[model samples]
Target: MSSFHIYGHRGSSGTHPENTLLSFQAAHKAGAQGIELDVQLTKDLVPVVIHDERLERTTNGIGFVKDFLYEDLVRLDAGHSFSSRFQGNSIPSLKSVLEWITSNSLMLNIELKNGRFPYDHLETKVLELLTHYHLYDRTIISSFNHYSIQRLTQNGCKVETAILLMEKLVEPWDYLQQVGANSIHIECGAIDEYFITNTHKRGIPVRAFTVNDPYQIAALKKAGCSAIFTDFPLVAMQSI
Candidate 1:
């Protein structure tokens, strides 16, 4: 059963704030076995953990996350929409997350959001960070951008990689095999039991994203999914 892992999507985003230390803490407390987070580099080449190209949705800041330096990003309030419970939280660096993640035997699935990867020194820099923390074995790199995953794997990262798809895929396993990825991080809206079955037959595990509803979680389990990423890790722990 591989322990039927629950990965907190952008941390326990439903209860705490999204993409902040508070959210990841809440997820860990909520009993998530892993965390699924996005990584985008700054102009200074800092790997910051966040989702979205723009900061408008989650934080009080405007403009692109990639355009800002690490100092500029750390000053913004990431928990603006979540009320007083998490008022001062800021978006954390990938380095910050690596330090905290070592306290437990938790797994990390980091999504590379940058395009045009094989990105000069970017892949090496990311690998250096993971190696610094000695977390290569406990981590899995994922991406919708196949090149990023390929670049990282080719550079001899000890971690495995996962392929992401937000749309319905025909012959998805072919994509996974071609990318040298053994796992699929599927969008919940586009998956079906047949997809899961076909993926499983190829010895690949399928995990759906952002699943919160009990019925949907039950359905995913019945459909033989390997895992799920959820905003509601607390709800998921209960449902699963």
Candidate 2:
């Protein structure tokens, strides 16, 4: 149980603005070993750290992330909606985030946001960024889009890849193997003893997402999960 890792979901999102550098720093301060963030491409092809294809929810901007140029995206306030304390937080570029993570000696789980926007060459762009930073050894790239996962594998990325699943599969491990994924990221509701046991049988670990409650964390830990992705990593660290 002590071996389980705590990954900051959207980088301490419960407290700070999700995907902002401040949020990531807060997660690291909370003692999270890894940070999980989403990436989407701007109209000008720059990769930025953000969760949604649409900007309204996360930033004080209108329209889809792909519709905005990189320069314009930078002008939006990503933190104000969260609170006054984080008023000017800007959306971070993947490059910036990578540098921060490298300096802090933290692991990263980059979830490609291509599932919703289908940005052209998103996988390749992300791979290039990881390679530029020499972060493959410490990064796990995941996506709900199995095609994106396959693309990364086919491109010969050595970074660990995981398939994100929101529902139960008849044979989750088999699907993971077929997709060439090294691990699985299952939604908390989809986790069960059967899935965990079979994944462990195959020697691959499972990760749970959006887990915050102490009881839920304890249950997932008891079920032998590899890690828990939490918006409240501070609370998670304290609870465990």
Q: What C-alpha lDDT, on a 0 to 100 scale, does residue 122 get in candidate 1? A: 58
- Model 2 lDDT per residue over 142-178, tens place: 9999988987787777999999989999988888878
What are the TM-scores, per candidate, against the unseen true structure? 0.93, 0.97
* Candidate with best lDDT: 2
Model 1 scores worst on lDDT over the 10 consecutive residues at 114-123
Q: What TM-score does structure 2 among the candidates reach?
A: 0.97
Which is the leading candidate under TM-score?
2
lDDT of 2 at 47: 93
Note each model's CA RMSD in angstroms: 1.9, 1.2
